[model samples]
Target: MVTDRFNSLGRPARLVALCLLVVAVAFLVLGRWDLALAIGAGALLGWVLLKPVRITWAIFAVAFMVPVTIDLGYPTNPSYTLLLVLFVLAGWGRLHRAERDGWPPRRIGAALLLPFCAVLAGVLHWHGVKPVVVGVAPLLCIGVLGWHLIEEARRDPKLILRIAEVFTWVSVAVAALAKYQTLTGTWPLFDQFAYDWTYTSVFDPTRAAGFFGHPIVYGSFAMAMALVSLTIRGRYWYVPFTANLIGLVLSGTRSAWVGTALALGIWLLLNVRKIAWRGVATGVIITVVAFAAVAVNPSTFRIGTSEPPPTWVSPTEPGTKPSPSPSTSSVDSVGVAGARMSDPVGSASASARFERIAVAWDGITRDWSTVIFGNGPESSVRYLEDVGIGDGQAQVFDNTYLTIWHNFGLVGLLSLLGLLLALFWRSRSLAGRLIIVGFAAQIFFFDVWLWLSAVGVLLLAVALGAAEDRPWPTLPFLNGLRKRRPRAPETSDASTPGFAAAA
Candidate 1:
């Protein structure tokens, strides 16, 4: 009777406990050790209620609201660190009670392990312990959370849909904030960072960033979640989807626009067999509404939307093209970063990308060992620092595959590809695969696979889910321990008869 009653109220108690824990931890990390102890006590007292789903929502909140690394000496971000600890602890609470379901086969496990092993090898061979930990901690932490979510999903097939709904609500909140920022020109959370300072625009109000550090991540993630919204069940799905699309356009990220369109086009083609007419109509309506919003608020939303592609011109010299005019290269600014300007030569967006590719190729070929094991991230940084480009050094290769190839060598790059292909094999949803496709394309434009980029978490979670993690029981500290029964004694006569096989 007591167990039954406790079970009835367990969920709510847990939710409260989880909230207290986050507050406590946030305070503690911020140096309020006294308040931390108090709130932590509340969480410990209500331990039974901490659920994986609840913890995940909390993680989502932290990821969106405080994506930046807290003002700590360590490179780890507060959200990443807190989410890692809280998620693992909360998930540990139920692991012993769950049942095994849809676990991956040995071959698939081996396939996934390949990429990790490659990275580990790189860590050991190139980067020392401390540097590697600082470099790879966020990715590892998020990957662990992904596996945790997968385990929970195995116990309940509906978990994926529920997660999708959570993602939609988060997107809705971000969209609302984006609209507010659009109107005010100042982001409430960013503290005096007016829209003009961070985002580009043709009018007073510029491209929006929701709650993210950059407009690019905000738009990309919104579009990705918009895709997720369509896959979920609900008549109101269109609402969030439209809102995210509006946010996406308001971001004014050209790469995002192209990448999202490509992903949606792929999703539509593959889902043609199973998709409903309502879903199709709803997608059309969402697209139309988003574009309509762009049309309605030309002053607020227009950035690169009205500009036509730059025309290709003949070289003025033997092998040199004319530099972009000041109008093309520079925008007026009255902010701290000052008037930002794109480089007209080597650092120019178009020229810089090609220059980076050349630099990456040169770095990898500098030594034979680097081609096999690849250059380390630290070494890559060092190499870029030495190789003078413009006034600054080039740190990125401007391509995801190139970055991976430069870091992990041919073996690691191949393993990474295998892992990605295997993830696609395990994934059942076309939309899920489409998300992968979108990021794969976007990486060519910018390297987002590292650290806490939106795609970083999304890719890991979706991939782990597709891998079909097995659920396990998370036992209580002492009460859930298995008890052994005593063995029964055998008769001496039966033992004697069997000793010599006497028949």
Candidate 2:
């Protein structure tokens, strides 16, 4: 009877079973028995809660396979990775099957570039074989997941909102835990438990870095959650808003503050017409109340230091001597140190970035082949290392556009820019267009374009797939160019006669 039941199962089910078995075995071999158990539990949970979708499964498989790092010392948690894989699979699967048609080429094409770039890097032997391999794998996985999401959204617009909800709740839980840890001096559970420096804030409470390593990452994640919560309709919108706000306040990352505010502001301005004013008013009230409470209790609002000293104030200048008091002197010394840290070109971080960018540009210009095709993926790391800067220095590129230019040259840069432009042009709703614009703003200061955070990826994916108002096929470009569609006349019931009686 058991054998017969097994035989009755369809090919897809069998395939899934086999895949799970392989994953289990792989985990066991890697000595991650707990992760194997978690995977099994997750599989069961996913099956029960989410109807299995083929494209989702495929995308999940692709995403899972991409993180094949030979070194294994890359400081990633096996359980967290498993969770990410499971969620990506379940979420993408649910989305793909919910939609009517498959993913479009433009979307797929954009996603494919990540893996293609990785492959090109490998072939070019940039940053050695390991960096290329490591870099490409994650890109490949993220790309597959992205493609799956785009395809899924085409079927059900609501699915994205649902995914956003789940993501927000999880982030809230994480943020709450981080906050608890911050207040009590207890260690947080998971990999973040070891990141003790995150809690060493004197001015502000350390940023609540739930599952992510850094407070900045956590802040960025919370920002995304806040935006999602605001955009979607839900019974408990305040929950996400409150949680994300708390998380952001605790994170103490100025960049996160800027990014989140910009993103949220743009989202609101564009979609104000569609938004529920009552909800907006309530949120605003809650925020105001919270801010007041925090203001009264200054300790609650504090996170890290106020700011690093300006990098241009020279200690050698007249009347620049350090102060006598310890606190004052410390601040003064920091200022002097910051000034001394400036490069020969009088640029602090800004100058260093400009210098490096100029060098990269020069290198690209010197070779037309490099300019058109890029030196390959991970080439910038190797190039920087060759120029006396260590591998760590390669991370100093603050500008994503500059990084793209240095690593992929003009072609890669243009391709990425074009993708962004296309996505912006394709956006239909005001909210969608604004979200894309905000994301574009972020790329100028941060490298989130490639990061694998759920919030970041979700924001980018949603922005890319959002529906735009396109001209009807039957209408000519110039047809009714200035004519406005007549608004439907408002109707009133005679039985509701207060206004009628007054008239």
Strongest candidate by lDDT: 1
TM-score for model 2? 0.61
lDDT of 1 by residue, 132-174 (tens): 5544554455445555555555555465656566777778888
66 Cα displacement, candidate 1 (Å) = 3.8
Q: Per-residue lDDT for 378 in model 1?
A: 43
The residue ranges of model 2 lying beyond 4 angstroms of the native Cα positions read: 1-104, 114-136, 184-187, 190-205, 271-284, 292-367, 384-396, 428-434, 454-460, 463-503
Per-residue lDDT of 1-503 in model 2, one digit per residue for the tens? 96786678789977887799799989999999877876786676555444544433333232222222121332464323543564467455635454655446766678778567556635653456666665565555555555555555555555555555666677668666656645432333432223223222221222345555545556666666666566553668777777777676665544566667776665555445556878679868879854542233224355874533212222466544322111210122222223434443464445555666667677567676676666677666566666644332334455667666656666667766776676555543333444455556655655553344523444444533453222211122222542353433367442422211222
TM-score each candidate: 0.66, 0.61
